[model samples]
Target: MEQPNSPEAAADRVLDAALMHVAFDGWTDATFRAAVLDSGVDAALAKALFPRGGLDLAIAYHRRGDTLMREALAKTDLSSMRFRDRVAHAVRLRIEAVEDREAVRRGTTLFALPLHAAEGARLIWGTADAIWDALGDASRDLNWYTKRATLSGVYSSTVLYWLGDDSLGHQATWDFLDRRIEDVMRFEKVKAQLRENPLSKAILSGPLKFMENIRKPVVPDDLPGRVMDRFRPKS
Candidate 1:
């Protein structure tokens, strides 16, 4: 329900225009300028919308993919699927949401730079968080971090494999994903066994006590501090 000239709308316009140049320019300053010109948003306004230029646009594009994945997850019937299958479905939806492989390829290159590495990790974490949130994760403690952290590893590896996979229907990538998820399931099973064993649990009591205090992160919803919201990864 945003107005036509709202900042969000303008940002979307610039992003739409920038996508055309990302594959060729790899989300550089040149592409940012071209997008501003192509989007017909004032140069100053475009700058205000994306102060970091192409990097911000790339972040926006990645979040847009996450949003698309969330929407797809909402519409799909996942009730009949097993827990692991649902996780795989969500990851596949996230990857399949990509409109341009080359754009993501370029993004991978841009974010791989040491200067932008942290932002890249945040985006991946954001995606993993979105997948878990969409699937009705109720963990409020350390499990919240553990679930996303574990899935982040699975999702990142799967993406790398997917980019290189040219198999029919990317069956190879899906197979790789299943294997990775199975590995995680095995690890989780081991953790459960350790917790169930009295001796092992006693030995790890100190660390377990520390972990008990860890909780899910929360962003304040104060309206006056909304300007900083742009920097946050959308859920």
Candidate 2:
């Protein structure tokens, strides 16, 4: 039965329907349209609720999830946390958020890929690798947005792969994630090394000096001489 329509209620219905459609039919334009129709809402309202359609809704969901994760991250002193712990926390938060949403739709216990098992370990590692690449240099402004986008892309791809992976014990997907994490970790190490290198320091420092020079007004050669003359000790 269709829910009674308040603006908020109507929007919720659309989102609920859309998620169900994606779960069953996969995320596609046609599926989204079908979802809207199934939800028993006016098409105009659905279109307004999702301006770019299902893809937009999907992206919005990811963005909302990222926002939630970032809020949690902001409250923590990441410097105090070990790197692996931080990575694990971040990954787990994201996975749980997705699983919770899935539970709302499907009402089942979604299992975490076991971290100790070979396949499960691989999945965790691969996701971590992609996350590191997305994060880049740990600069709050640059790395945060980049990593969020990268994580979203990796997560979506991972979900798709998982759906299709029916191998014994679902080991194939886990193995794939493991390899992915290793590659990302290797790249992150290289990035960390480059940042720490003397040459990189010199290069970054050079730009700062150049900016300082540009900010100050260029003085005429006579200006220094005049200033010196004013300060000259009596002969």
Candidate 3:
């Protein structure tokens, strides 16, 4: 529903042009100029629309996908699904939001640059946070941080997997996504179990030395044998 010529609409036009060029130029300032030129908008408008040039254009591209996912999610009633299923739907919808394979490939190649790798991470973090928010997550503390962290791993892996998928309908990628979600579930279960165990309480409260071998049995195999032999009569 973009108006014919608003600032926001103009930015969209520039961004649309940028995507067309990214597959060819890999999100460079060259791509930015070309997009502005191709859009027939004033070149200065690129600075106003994306001050950081190509990097900002890349972020905006991601934001457009996030917006599409959010809009589609609004139409669904996720209340009936389990939280994991809801999470699955949310991620799948986000992936579906991206229709341009070349655009995604170029974005990945652009972000792989050492300077922009951090930027790429921030981009992934943004999408994770967006997906969680779109799913109506309401946690407001450490849980919020942990939730986003976990989903960040899930979303990143799925996106990478999706990039190489050649299956009809990308069914293989969806399977990979399901497995990653299951990994999260199993990890949470492990964390819960550890919290319920008294040994974990000791590990948290005990001396730092205790933590070094927390995964091992409480009694050292060699220590127990040596102690028992010492207790026997010295012969």
Most lDDT-accurate candidate: 1
Question: For each candidate, what TM-score against the reference?
Answer: 0.93, 0.48, 0.83
Off by over 4 Å in 1: 226-235
| Full ranking by lDDT | 1, 3, 2
How does model 2 fare in lDDT? 0.55
- The better-scoring model by lDDT among 1 and 3 is 1
lDDT over C-alpha atoms for residue 79 of model 1: 88
Q: lDDT value for candidate 3? A: 0.84
lDDT of each: 0.94, 0.55, 0.84
lDDT of 1 by residue, 1-235 (tens): 6589898899999999999999889898899999999999999999998999989999999999999999999999998999999999999999999988888888888889999999999999999999999999999999999999999999999998988999999999999999999999999999999999999999999999999999888776666878688788865
- Which candidate model has the greater lDDT, 1 or 2? 1
Q: List the residue pairs that clash in candidate 3.
A: none
> Residues 37-144, candidate 3, lDDT per residue (tens digit)?
988877777688888888889888988998888889889998899999889888999999998988888888888899889988888888888888888777665567
